[model samples]
Target: MDTAILPLGTVIRRQADSDEQAIRLWLHGKSAHSQRAYTSDIERLRSFVVRPLPQITLDDLQGFADSLADLAPASQKRTLAAAKSLITFSFKIGYSTFNVGAALTVRKPKNTLAERILSHEDITRIIEREDNPRNHAILRALYETGCRVSELCGLKWRDVQPRDGGLAQVTIFGKGGKTRHVLVSQRLHEELCRLRGSSGTDAPVFPSKSGRALDQPAVFRVIQGAAKGAGIEQRVSPHWFRHAAASHALDNGAPISLVKEQLGHSSLEVTSVYVHARPTDGLFKFLNR
Candidate 1:
């Protein structure tokens, strides 16, 4: 902590001096992935600031968000999110007593159409085309458990638990080091058992070609290749599986809270993004009636 760097006057002044260092320290203390995202966000914000941060007016913040509208909706949303984070961080670090960013609003983007889930048939096609047993097991585990690619990559053999004389569940260390249990299908259990015979307990459940834990990009490639082999014309990624699981689970009447927990989301509002309401099944149906 450099006391000389501390600014005089209002909270905003102190924040202008201390906020950048605080944000950097805070980000460094977070997961590497999160650090990368937040760093990019802060840099973008810096580009938008015409004056010293302490001198940035509320109008400037609003104007920056407005300027983002011409970009892709996803990019706009990501930039807005980043701006919100920086503003929030500044407030937390005593840069400003009032949250000027909080008063600013961004338009909500239209939800993209629901992605096509891999039907049992589609799953079968992928599994059949995967000649590598390791790849097969990885896909099965993802499809069966709805684990995020990162969570699956972080998995260890010890995380798999056998119960009732069968492999029953897997303990996943999700984002933020939160742990949750996902039931493993009997077939997946058998696959793990076979895999375990060859790999060590401390080793990654899904290793890369280099024999290290599989990274997110490698997993993405595996899914892409499998989707291509299954004859899916649309691009598919690991996130498609997650969205598919959430949509299917909601369709089958799984409670929203449970789905939120499974997805490791901190807020039910975030989980609601996955629950799609059919136009034909809603109040619109009454109009037709």
Candidate 2:
């Protein structure tokens, strides 16, 4: 009989019957949104462990759970859940007989109040305060398109289509690498066209000083600058625009499904958060009578 030694990567693959590779492959197969979340969870767990895989003991798992106390209970629980999934998958594939994550317990965190959304007035003030044409377009595009800051930054000129007889739409690649078409108002479309003429089609729709796509921090600064100039004192971020758009759309009688599609939500459960934020009509006054 002849025995052959496997390559290092192949050795790792055969040791656990490719369990780690299976987990990695499975992670990649998930939506981009899920991949990001699971990767973060795995990173946090790796930080908690003192040794590499197969060397990690039950004590390490317990220590990781204990360390999670510093994080909100909800967050801790979610991270643990992610770790558990990975461990379970590893076990199923014969990587290890122990299910460390399965034995771990997570503490529940207190539920905090929901964050406040920007009012129509606040949005108006922010827009009015933006004096620069580019800044104005950025702000308007966020509110009009209901896109995340990342999606906005990734936008290119080719994504926008302006036609004389049809509604203008912008193609957005949202979380999870999901693509959706967002309608742009005629006014916003024209403004975008003007902005595009000045900044070339190949260039990012929202570019930094270096002409690269604007990063998260830059997007935050742009929103902060606009908010400060508008004289609105509320703590604002790019997500506020998404919240505001969802709220406004529901308030204006857009269907829940339409809102979900616009927001790029995969589930109605996620979109329900916006629906819950809808302002109530004066029913209390009538009900009291």
Candidate 3:
């Protein structure tokens, strides 16, 4: 018997000799959104665990997890999960003799999707209030397509095309390098065409004044401004449109499975959360006086 633990040849082409190199390799293939999020999460972990990667013990991770008590449950989970992933990657690359984070487990956070969902009326008010052609189109695209802010920001005119009956379709390069095609409403299709004008197909569908793609932060500001202008008291983000899209779709009889594909959800279970959040038929309704 070869008693030694062989390197994971399939996972990586070579061993990561240092923690820094291992960290780079771990984030190498992730989407930009994930890379940014995981970087912040890892940075939070680093502040607590000062020791080198291989030298860190379970106690260190436990203390790090403990430090996250002040953060919201979702934030805590994201931070701890990032640390566990990093340590596990280091171990897999043979940089660490043991996976220090393997024993540490972060509990799943409570679902808050219901709280974030915007009513269709609220969504309409926001869109109807935005007078700028570009911003108006942005709001509609986000709502009608149910795309993530990152996906919307990264969208190019080339990714959109005419389908049958004046409807347009979008090829979204979503998370984990997955590709999903979502149908665009005919109204939105015409709006996008009007916005495109003379711009090249390679140009971003939503471009800044500098002719660059509208980044996520800019899109966020657009959502916030629109929501505020619409007299919405609650804070709004680009994701509100996504939630509204899912919820409103299910409310209007769109199939859950279809919503799953449009949103590029990993599983039917993920798509089902929208249904669960706003269940159409409930026993409580039957008990109404």
Per-model TM-score versus the true fold: 0.82, 0.77, 0.93
Query: Which one is best on lDDT?
Result: 3
* Candidate 2: clashing pairs of residues: 73-109
lDDT of 3 by residue, 80-183 (tens): 88899999888777677778798997899999889999998999999999999999999999999999999998899899999999999999998889999999
Per-residue lDDT, model 1, residue 111, is 72
lDDT of 2 by residue, 62-105 (tens): 77888887877778888888877887666545465555666776
Runs of candidate 2 exceeding 4 Å displacement = 1-41, 53-63, 72-78, 88-114, 165-167, 198-200, 279-289
By summed lDDT, the worst window of 10 consecutive residues in model 3 runs over 1-10
Candidate 3 stretches with Cα past 4 Å from truth are: 1-14, 283-289
- What's the count of clashing pairs in each model shown? 2, 1, 0
On a 0 to 100 scale, what is the lDDT of residue 9 in model 2?
Answer: 28
Error of 3 at 180 (Å): 0.9
In the range 1-289, model 1's lDDT, one tens digit per residue, is: 2111223543333434555675664575576667777788667777877565546667988888877767888778888877776776666666645557777777777677454555556766876798778888888788767788888888998888887757577998877878988776788898888877677778888877687899988889999898898898788888777767776777778898888888778899887876653221667756865
RMSD in angstroms, all models? 4.0, 5.8, 2.9
Please give the ranking of all candidate structures by lDDT, highest first, separated by commas.
3, 2, 1
Task: State the C-alpha lDDT per candidate.
Answer: 0.74, 0.77, 0.89
Error of 3 at 83 (Å): 0.7
lDDT score at residue 242, model 3, on the 0-100 scale:
94
Report residue 175 deviation for candidate 2 (angstroms). 1.5
Candidate 2: lDDT over CA atoms? Answer: 0.77
